[model samples]
Target: MKLETLSVRIGRDVEPMAGDVAPAIHMSTTFERDSDGEFSRGYSYARADNPGRKALEQCIAALEGGHDATAYSSGSAASLAVFSLLRPGDHVVAPIESYHGTAKQLRDIIGPMGVQYTFVDMTRADAVRAALTPATKLVWIETPSNPMLNVSDIEAITALSHERGAIVCCDNTFATPVWQRPLRFGVDLVMHSSTKYFGGHSDVMGGAIVTREGGTLSERLRDYQGTAGNTPAAFDCWLLRRSLTTLVCRVRAQTENAARIAEFLSTHQGIERVFYPGLASHRGHDIARKQMQGGFGAMLSFCVRGGREEAFAVAGKMKYFTRATSLGGVESLVEHRASIEGPHTVTPQNLLRLSVGLEHADDLIADLDQALASRS
Candidate 1:
């Protein structure tokens, strides 16, 4: 079955709960073996495995149209598991404007671990090709790239990388499973900071990895997920699992709110630019439209007529849209990106990124209107 159809129907098929009713929380740290010092099922323990985590993983794997999935403590943990696949002296190529934490991981952390990397502007597929080397083990992609909203052409980069026997890893955080599924684009792996959209409520901090087939890749990742000792707690796993039930609905609503807000901001008197893939004015709008389902995601950014001072006042003045950093929650969040990163960071001073929420569109618009008017 297709992922969209399966996302709504996958976890319900299992008889894990009584008579196929709502699933209960299994907070077990360990499980008993049947006999002969051998266990008889797919799970053994909470650290290595848990029934709750398994349910979520299976559902997520089905959503990504992959054979297997593993859940982690955070998106960073999931990414670290993929990075461990690279050996010392291996080469990695990633987008220059990808997530900042991911960039730090490659340059400051993994690079010191003897891994070499080249940060190229991913909007240029040719640049990715030019950076390729025999040691290139992976190409990391972040579509609708962070902060600035630049998108990469996954089909072109993934196809080129595959020819050289390198894996393609896409961080599908910005475009949730609801909007984009990278596996369909021939990506080798799909991962999510499930903490964002999958959890849907911003209450759980977890990550997940999905692969096309369940084999060595699955086993290797599971081994790392276990060894790293960063697996999500049973409670967190259960929370995330519960969040899955409303994933589609919440994302759809948030996307709708985002589209309305983006449209308003696009031609607003005091706004200079809006960076939403949903907008036809966006450079990535066509590619995002071609590859994505439904709406382009709830996250977006817009620059004010003035720089940092004006952006800060705009962010500070919002009443309904709370000024916060993390996104993908039931409530709206607004942030001054450049302030969060300080002086040395890449986020521009004039930019304000928003995580649109389920609030009434008029209220959100009111908040924005007052905030922008205050700046004017």
Candidate 2:
């Protein structure tokens, strides 16, 4: 089945109950043992597994063309699970322009745990290759990267990492499986915040990790999740499954609106620069075009003409776009990323990140137009 069809039908079947169209949320934390001393239904405890989370995992695995998936409490938790697969002294190479949370986790949390990481400009394949060492166990790739929209060549980087006997993991939050499936490009693992796009609305918080071949590494991640008890609640899993049904439709509309807005910003006099993969003028346009399907993405960043104050002014003046963080929602959002990322942020002070939504393209453009005009 196609992605659109799979999204709605993958986990909809509920057996031995009423013929309800939607899947039921199995919120029971523990399952009863039958006969002697075994759980015949394959569920013993919530920490190990839940019916709703299992359904979600199957659906996501199908979408990403992976063998299996493990859902987590948050995207960061999902990332940490992968890091947990490594021991002390294991090294990782990641993009310098990654989501600040992921960077912080690698620097502050994982680093102290004895895992070493090197931040590199992933857009340059050479830089990624150069960052690898004998101890490098993983290479993290984030295409159409956060706050900057820099697209990296996934296949090229994956090949480089494979040659050095390292696993390559791609953060597909920005370009969901609907746009780009990294497993097909030889990525060992694909990670998603799920809270952003998979949840569709800004309500639920969840994360997922899908493994291409379901090997020992996948088993280790499952072990970490079950042991650490970082699994999502039954209700959250059900909500995410509900959101998956409309994933393709929402993303297509959001991407369309973003393309229009990026074009408008590129031509506007008050804008210094626009960072969107869809834009032909963007540095990664060709690479993004080659890899991404349908549309570039709904996320984009633009620099205000003056500086931080001018950027904040534009964000503050927006009427339709909410002045908040987080993306892949029904409602639009605009944020001065540097302010949110703090002192260690590499995001330009003059740049504002926009999470385009399902609003009318013209309305979004008009809001941006007026916002920029206010600064003039």
Candidate 3:
């Protein structure tokens, strides 16, 4: 079935108790056992499994074409689950510029735990290949990386990791399954901060990891999830499941808006550079063209003519684009990413990241135009 069909139909098979089309949310913390003291339904406890979470996991697995998926309370929890698979003295390779939270986890949290990691420019596959060693257990790829919007070649990196006996995990938050399916590129695992695109409305917070083959790594993550107990609430799972129904439509609309905004920024005198894979001028245009399916993506970033002060001024001048953190929502958001990422950030002081939303392209452009003009 097509992604559109799968998004809406995959989890709708539940037998609604009241003849309602919407799937019911099982809010009970625990399920009853049979009179013989044996488990009857597939579920025994909410922490171990819940109907809503199971439906969401099934939906995400079907969408990404993965063998199975594990849902988490937050995207960070999902990252931690994957990192927990690595033992002391194990090595990992990741992009130099990625979601700050994930990078921090690898560098600060996991690094001190005895696991080693190397951060390299993943856009250059040679850099990644050079960073790998016999000790390397995983290669983390985040195409169209956060803030910078640097697109990495997933297939190239995956092949290199496979040659070295390292599992490859792709962070697919920026490029949702509607745009790019990393599992199709032979990535061993695909991860997402479902709080962003999957949640769509910015109300739900969740994370997920889908395994292509469901091997030992998948088993480990499942075990860690159950034991650690960092699982999404039943209502959050239900909300995420509901959001999937319109994932394709929402992302496509945002993609179109982003393209228009990027084009506008490219020609504007106040802008120094635009980071959008959809733009022909982007360094990753050709590779993105090959990997991404329907659209480039809604996320983009640009450097204003001056430095931090000028960038903050521009962000402050926006009328429609809310000055906030987080992305992949119906409403547009603009952020001075450097400030948001704090003192440890590598994002340029002059750069502002934009999360193009479902707003009309012209209105968003006008808001940007006014902001840029005010800066001049």
Candidate 4:
């Protein structure tokens, strides 16, 4: 089935008894036991299993073309679950230009646990290959990387990782399944902050990991999820499942809006540079063209003509885009990348990240024009 059709159809079965089109949100923490002392319904507890989470996991797995999926309370938990599978003395390779939270997890949390990691420029396949040690068991890829919009060649990275006997996992949060499917490029796992596009709104928070094929790795993920007890609540799962019906439509629209906005900023005098893969001048445009389908993506970032203060002035004057953290929502958002990342941030002081939304391209452009206009 086409992605759009699948998005709406995946979990839309009518309730057998209620005769309702919308699937019922299974909220019971525990299920009934059979006379034989077995949980024949296939669910003994909410932490172990829930109908809502199962439906969500099934929907995301199908969408990503994966064999199975595990849902988590947040994207961090989903990522941590992957790291948990590795033992002490294991090594991981991750992108230097990635979400700060992921870096923090590696440096402060995972590293101290005795699992070492090396942060390299994932945009360069050779760099990644050189960084891998015999102990490396995982290669993490975050294409269209957070704040920077850097794109990595998934097929190349996956090949290198597999050659080294390392599992490759790509964070598909920025590039939703609608545009890119990492599993298609031989990535072992695909991860998402379903809290972003999957939820389609700021109302819900959740995460998910979809495996290319079920085996020892997938089984371990399931065990860790149940034992950690950090799976999404029943309502969050239901909300995310309902939101999936519109995933394709919403992401495409937001992508179009972003392309237009990127174009406008690229030529504007107040902009030092626009970081969008859709632009031909962008460093990763060719790789993105080869990998992404439908459109580039909804997220873009640009540098102000001056420094941090100038960027702050531009953000302050914005009339439409909200100055906020987080992305992948219906409402446009603007954020000063470095300020939010704190003192250790490698992000350029002049860079401002924008999360384009479902708003009309023209209105968003005009608002940006006025915001960047001369104040004298």
- The lDDT values for all models are 0.86, 0.93, 0.93, 0.93
Candidate 4, residues 1-376: lDDT per residue as tens digits? 9899889888777888979898898989999999999998899999999988998998999999999999999999999999998899999999988899888899889999999999999999999999999999999999999999999999999999999999999999999999999999999999999989999888999999999998998999999999999999999999999999999999999999999999999999888899999999999999999999858999999999989999999999998899998899999999998987765588999999999999899999999999999721
> Per-residue lDDT for 215-257 in model 2, tens only?
7988988999999999999999999999999999999999999
In the range 117-146, model 3's lDDT, one tens digit per residue, is 999999999999899999999999999899
Better TM-score candidate (1, 4): 4
TM-score of each: 0.95, 0.99, 0.98, 0.99
lDDT of 3 at 330: 99
Q: On a 0 to 100 scale, what is the lDDT of residue 292 in model 2?
A: 93
Q: Candidate 3 — worst ten consecutive residues by lDDT sum?
A: 11-20
> Going through the candidates in order, what is the number of backbone clashes in each?
0, 0, 0, 0
Which has the better lDDT: candidate 1, or candidate 2?
A: 2
Displacement of residue 208 (Cα, Å) in model 1 is 0.6
